[model samples]
Target: MPEKQRYTLPTKAGDQRQLGELTGAACATLVAEIAERHVGPVVLIAPDMQNALRLHDEIRQFTDQMVMNLADWETLPYDSFSPHQEIISSRLSTLYQLPSMQRGVLIVPVNTLMQRVCPHSYLHGHALVMKKGQRLSRDALRAQLDSAGYRHVDQVMEHGEYATRGALLDLFPMGSEQPYRLDFFDDEIDSLRLFDADTQRTLEEVEVINLLPAHEFPTDKAAIELFRSQWRDTFEVKRDAEHVYQQVSKGTLPAGIEYWQPLFFSEPLPPLFSYFPANTLVVNTGSLETSAERFQADTLARFENRGVDPMRPLLPPEALWLRVDELFSELKRWPRLQLKTDHLPEKAANTNLGFQKLPDLAIQAQQKAPLDALRKFLESFSGPVIFSVESEGRREALGELLARIKIAPKRILRLDEAQDAGRYLMIGAAEHGFIDTQRNLALICESDLLGERVARRRQDSRRTINPDTLIRNLAELHVGQPVVHLEHGVGRYAGMTTLEAGGIKGEYLMLTYANDAKLYVPVSSLHLISRYAGGAEENAPLHKLGGDAWSRAGKKRRKKYAMWRRNCWIFMRNGRQKRDLPLSTTASITSYSATASRLKRRPIRHRRLTPY
Candidate 1:
């Protein structure tokens, strides 16, 4: 080595100044010092392709044909899902192999282009350093993440994502190989590593290397196999249903055929899919100043404008894919990102080409512990209370407890059952022989876990009830009292609103007979109706819908949700109707049917044989 020197460049106060605040002049000076000492091609690594391109382009000015970006080279594409070699050769080999006619400087984004790069091949085996604070349990870290201003970002990699399955905690962070695995020791972090998301096994260490945002080998064999196995069962059921449907249309199957056997149940399918696809995700790298600034501004805007929480936790890493053709094309113009060469093992190089779906790791949910804390929160409230929970088991337990504590048996209603039955089921098993005053207690239970896997269930019962039902239920004043609302179709009385609108007036609500419509009934209409002949819970304090209490409560809930949406931008899937159209038409069948019908028809004389 000859020598090395350090220098700092002054930032120019202009709009078009380079983002890094350095110019090509300074870069050329640095390259000259390195070139004089180096014997061969120089290598550069960048966070993104754009930076790689900039560095390569800048260096090219001094040494006419010196810099060459690997992304600019042409290579066969490989399917990322299947095993394939991505790295073609080292920077030295690439330069040595170049034709005599192609002599120049070599520049490449080391990580992005090293498709063949795997720690397994490099180090063979090296034990990663295991530190105590470094290994955090999903639940423990989630609390920290809550304070970190990170949540699920829809378009970015799952940065602060956590998920649990029984004892296993999966976290996919930016630049880590595989998602990090935090096996629990009684809800504590026992061990951690970048494990294969599919296999759930610790990735065999190739080399002790710094993690990257992009995954070289993200697919785990287990997740893929699980999907493949389940697909056949799904296809068979679909095929059978199609046959049955066609037969019924032809008048072969009876009208009650559908009632005999339903196509499939809804509860189990969502979790199966949830385990894999949601794991592999790519986060936006913020490669550009404008992009980074946009993200920051959005965060601030949400906090100030929407009252969003800034202390949410980090979401999981998202697996972003680069198409082979597009990858090659962009490299020619801007050679910065390291696009891996098709140097995968023979088996991998010849693999089929297509987009492989990877699990978005951002959705890993912390376990049931957090909800326990929330339950304790509701216990502190002594007034006419309204609480919300996620789990059905928790709801049932609460209902049982409230029945024993309160006197009015009719006032305690379990809303979960009402969701399935399409009506509110009031179970006021109060010990005081039905306190027929006002319907006071209202409980709302919500679970992110259930919502994660509820979409695939064929039954309507498992589907989330509309927010309106919860609102309308709060408007009710008494059990067995008939109440009507403009929005909700119709529902029996359940309870009154404990949700306040902060200090705003005219925001109180009464439970009504409707499906999931919690009517925000105004408090000014207290004198609109009389109690029913046999209504229970009638004597409790009548609340004016538009009172100050309603306003305070409503604002609080809004603030929490606004913060949540800002942090976790969970994208909702648009439902599509699956219609099976005949791939081929049969014109001959139509002609045959017409001719056969004509032949079968006989011209009957107007008078004689009709009497028979």
Candidate 2:
């Protein structure tokens, strides 16, 4: 790889410094520089979720250190539990990584930092790391799971649930992408494999798995008694309190109980700030004073509007969220750096940590002639230059563009090729690009040259495909909501209910149609049902049960889809034929003529064709 630009900033222990007017890439470079100088955990806070994610992506380009992103659970007024499983998993993973003392970077939004999390003691105690040959009785394993707040289910599908059958046990652990299947030979673990929840098939074998608690709160007997006692002390005898207390006493927790997790603990809950080491370097993208104030105001407004309802009791704002002043106080204990997108003032205060202004290295926007701009940039820059495109297609396009300008840039798959000083021009793929003027290198991105952002391709990761994955979470579904079935046009979703068929129990989705007709769809067929989203929910038309009209409409839609698929196949086949060129330069020109004639007879609309 090209040597990273080495720059120094005025940063000291127990000092707060403001970095002025650095772009996203510049900020990331600064963070990487600070990380190299310091030898501890680095926490970077952004103004919002979008900024946080963008900064994380930028920082990854500079360093290979363990970088974790903490996203907001959601912005809903009052949620018993966060609906986002990924965010919850990410938060837990970051917390788990923090205690290791391994150097890493954590990017998080200001709002996320304000929210309180489960105590560090609880998280450390509840986390389970099991390896092969870890001898433990089945009963003891069950008790461990119960203490970790996992619920026993008929089948292991979503996180926090487990199922046992004969000598086999399946568990969907928190912070895990897929559920694990343990084959026990009379309590001694025989084998373990990660399996797909939807197909109920093993994917791969593993020797060890680190499992985190599914929920934040404890669900054991003592935890229940503590919660009940706290609930009685907080609220007067009311219907909601009594109902929640009854459920907790019966060893079952109600939905949205996560909001009341603080009540379960006798001591005060801690914010994320408390978990960090004393030497951790805290970096703020913008003015922390401004962002924290806005976050606190927005949170207070949400709590004020929603905290008074008896039907949904909300945890007091002070208990669940930290004030701006309190957050600043906590941050003051660590060395803090503030990044701004504007120049610093002349007579600014807080000079304990001096300022180092980085040079402006923004790429000039391409005007009408992109080829001319590329040619000029290539000829003018003597140092190493890398052009980053988004995809293979863009790479080819850029190569063709450069070829027209008499420039033959070598296409390199890895950054190691650019380390050689002799190679000036190279092409590669990156999500975003920037120039490091200090290193005498420039990275021109496709977006900067073409003025069009490419859609990033998501990397495929192994995920547990449960029935819930096929549809919305059961908690999000409600009666009388409009739902659409592949066969049935549109109908109202009633609710989920259990039915027994052939002496085997299964859950099903109940849908209501016209004339009070009901259709019970097996949970396995969840992929066929979707929330009605054609138009306005109120204006959607419901179909009658067992109607011929629905079948006819479905057939017509299938026919159109099939035709579209055929067109896509033809386009792909033609493109492949073009790419399968002969290596010999003396190949017959007649073959090209024949291909051109065939193309003339069936003209290919390259622009209209979508990638397969």
Candidate 3:
């Protein structure tokens, strides 16, 4: 047996303690324990979004407390587009819940926490509560939705979109999982149904839904006035030619409008720290000071890079983001703990509580017993062990694996059902496993037993609009990527450019074909373009423009496809069968070739003498 590794964790968290020697899922375990014992809200600020999400998922297994992950916009500081609808919905939902949350676990990335969010009252004020029998007017609701930045679409397929048709009102509220169809009878709502966007079928019946604003900023007349007034005050420009000023004045919400959210608000937007209670305990991993500094640097870089877009003037980065020192000052308001996976820094506190991660299962490739180490650990471990897999299928598979190795284990659901000296299987996810020496409990995660897992690709929440636009917009396409043009063959995307044809300027996609041939396709015809996927792009054949090779290849492809569609049949018109006889075969004196040769020898004497 190898020497047992040990980590020092405090039994009770100090006002400002530095936790050291914690790695992988053990960090989540410690945070969960802190949340379980602490009376106030526990905030864990991770260095990045992925780490914060992993910790959030893992911590849920350890404690029954509410674990909320407030993610970032996943966009640049001065991007031309907004975040996805689902991401926006999630952020708004978390912001709405944060103020009322007395005690729970809130996990956030350092950058997310650094940005200022809309105040609680802003959302609460604009929100509308609808029930089964509420009196409503379609026109009034439509006007309100428009003011709230909700698009009046023909169908409510995404968040912050609403549609009205006669007595039925459909709206997908921000911060909601599903779109809702409100069936109204005359002036009152008769029924409310949550629906599936793809199938357009009602999934469940709901009595009430809280309608929050689509954008973080307001788009109403008053808010727009406030924004324009503030813009004049801030920029000191009147009747500016900026596209943002012109559009916002007309109450049209433009892309990447989040940068100007502060101007729309009557009061100053509040930081994330303000949402938490006075006694909120903050647990942070990694160097937040450095992260903040790096964020500020990236913000400045973006600010500089976006200077070319004269139509959309950017407010300074200081207005949008909190500085490193300001972030640190906010951290000072809460009881802080710095988590580390390596050796403690010089002169740190001497807090101690032993928590050891499960040792790696060392198995040789040619070894006879691959499960030998795991069997031994299960047999020797004194505390109850829980085998956590990523899902139910994994749980059952792991159960079978254990059973086949002559280690029968009980199947359980929750951690509370664990028993001393027993091995159990459960559905849970943890990056790694750990042994709590103080609690006499051991958790053997999938990673611990089977090694690293292949993470599943995240599926997009939004449904595909159409095949023509499988890629929603040209923004999805990048330079140097291969794309297929409907009329032309495969070409490499160069970039977007404005070309004037017949005295009119228009946007077009620049595609480079063979021999540096360029084809400028109209932006409106993006439907005819798609991303190419012919494996190993460097090896892909690029056909020359205005050449017959592409047409010939297309014809051949179409022919093969047509043949395959008809049961992949092969037309063997000249093929011979077992029952058929050849015409020139000399069999039973009925050979046509033999007779013809004989007649040819007789030639002119009796020309047509070859007869039956």
Candidate with top lDDT is: 3
All candidates' lDDT scores?
A: 0.31, 0.65, 0.71
TM-score of 2: 0.77
Name the candidate that leads on TM-score: 2
Residue range 138-239, candidate 2, lDDT tens digits: 888888997887877776656677888888888988887779998888868888899987667888899998988767667777888888798888864455
Model 3, position 286: C-alpha lDDT score:
88
How far off is residue 106 in model 2, in Å? 1.1
lDDT of 3 at 472: 31
Q: Tens digits of per-residue lDDT for model 3 on 463-488?
A: 12223223334657788888877667
RMSD of each: 35.4, 8.9, 18.5
Q: How well does candidate 1 score on lDDT at residue 165?
A: 61
* lDDT computed for candidate 3: 0.71
